[model samples]
Target: MRLLVINPNTSRGVTNRIREAADAMALPGDRFTTLCPAYGPELIVTEQDAALARQAVVDTVRGFKGPCDGIVLASFGNTGADPVRALRPSIPVVGIASAAFATARALGGPFGIVTFGKGLVPGLQAKVDEAGLSDALLGISCVAGEEFGDPGEVQTRFRSELEALCADMHQRGARSIVMGGGPLAGMARSLAPTCPIPIIDGTQAAISLIRAVAAPRGDHEPRRAAAPAET
Candidate 1:
């Protein structure tokens, strides 16, 4: 399937990280085209940032002309996913936050979220509530530290802290933990061994969910009548 993954923020570094995560999650014959809006916040951690990203995503999707079997809004909060989906109703749309929650629910237990900023917790909670998964939520943890010049380096910078947070969540009854930011895309797999429970990468969840939903539709064709049997 040909998938379009949108990083609502304009940070190329974050976009690159999202692309790497998408590539790692892809199945054979899956093609992912990842891009960022030309204008928006470098990161989406505030309501203002999300507001701008919503318009940016809408503009980006409006301007895109390439073939797309599915679309993924790569931001963990799923910034602009609804607007983009509205613009392209024919294509399947998967938001990383929603996908992550769905995967966590399917895994049959409560899940927690680990993200970059404390301010992001409310937004993440709102997403869970929106998806009707709040009842299954364990908690949300935040880790903030020295800023990295390259946002993509966030995962490495907070590796130790993230592992600790995941361990805490596990003890608190979380069966899985979600890495909850676009720049933290690939950290789940990287930190999985250190975490007692599963570390769910929103990007990977989005990719798998998109592929599953798009496959049947993309491969479907009008049925043809079988040749008449010879007497």
Candidate 2:
């Protein structure tokens, strides 16, 4: 199966990180093509930043001429996902935020989100409400520091900060946690082992959803057939 992954932000580092994480989860025959728009915010933290990134996402999808079984919007906020879906109704378009929320719900949560930038909390919270998962949401936490700094440094700092937040959420009745943001995908994978509860990475969650969507139905599954017309 083929998948098109779009990073709404212009940061190549984040885009590359997303690609690497997705590659690790890809099946032998599966192919993933990841790209970022030529222009957009390097990192989206504020509402204004997200607004610009959303436009870039829309433009990128509008200009893309590649063939793929599905598309993955590799951003926790799911910028431009609604427009993308509306523009391409025949294609499957999965967003990281929705994918992570779905996974968290399946795990029977009260799940919390741990991400960068305190400024993004409101947007993240809004997304939770939009998903109709407000009842299942525990809370949202942010790690201090620049969100688009060196990947290794960011991950190291995030791990320490996130661990504390996760523990706090656990005490607050959170059953699981979602490490939001596509750039933090690697960090999520690394931190999951040490976390007290399940940590759902947005990228990984999206990948899992994409695989399920691309997979063939079981032989016993019923197929929809056309009705016969009387002559």
Candidate 3:
């Protein structure tokens, strides 16, 4: 299957991180094309930023001409997913927030989200409510001042902060944790091993979920030729 991963933000750095995570999660025979709008905020931290990114996503997807079996909105905020899905009903759309939350629910308990800033907490909470998973959500924790530049540097700089947040979530009875933000994909991979509970990277979860939904099913078989008109 061919998947299109859209990072609504304009930051090439964040887009690259999303692409790396998608590529790592892609199954054999699956192809992923990752893109970002040429115009939008470098990072979507506020409502206005998200709004702009949403419009940009719609424009970008509408203009895209290549084959896309599925689309992954590669942002923890799930920017423009609904609009794009409405615009292209035939194509499957998966958003990182929804996918990660679903994966957390499947893991069987209350989950917490670790995001970049407090400003995003309410938005993420709203998504949990929208998914009808509010009961499964433990809470949200923020790690402020994390930069979206060089993945390696970002991961290194925020490692301690993320670890602390995860520890707090686990202490607060969270059975699983979602590391929100597409730019934080590398950090999620790095921190997962040490985390006591499952650490779901939203980008990776989005990729996996989309692929599962898009994969061909073999439950039905073709009917045999109608008995040759009664031999």
Q: Across residues 163-227, which tens digit of lDDT does each residue of candidate 2 receive?
A: 78777877888899988777687667777667778888887788789778765323442433211
User: Residues 163-199, candidate 1, lDDT per residue (tens digit)?
Assistant: 8888889999998888888889888888888877889
Task: List the candidate 3 regions with Cα displacement exceeding 4 Å.
Answer: 144-153, 215-231
lDDT for model 2, on a 0 to 1 scale?
Answer: 0.77
Clash-forming residue pairs, model 2: none
Error of 3 at 14 (Å): 0.7
Worst 10 residues of 2 by lDDT: 222-231
The per-prediction tally of clashing pairs is: 0, 0, 0
The positional error of residue 110 in candidate 3, measured at the CA in angstroms, is 1.4
Q: Write the per-residue lDDT of candidate 3 for residues 178-223, one digit (tens) a residue.
A: 9877777756777877778889988888777766677543334342
Top TM-score: which candidate number?
A: 1
C-alpha lDDT of residue 176 in model 2 = 90
Clashing residue pairs, candidate 3?
none
Which of candidates 1 and 3 reaches a greater lDDT? 1
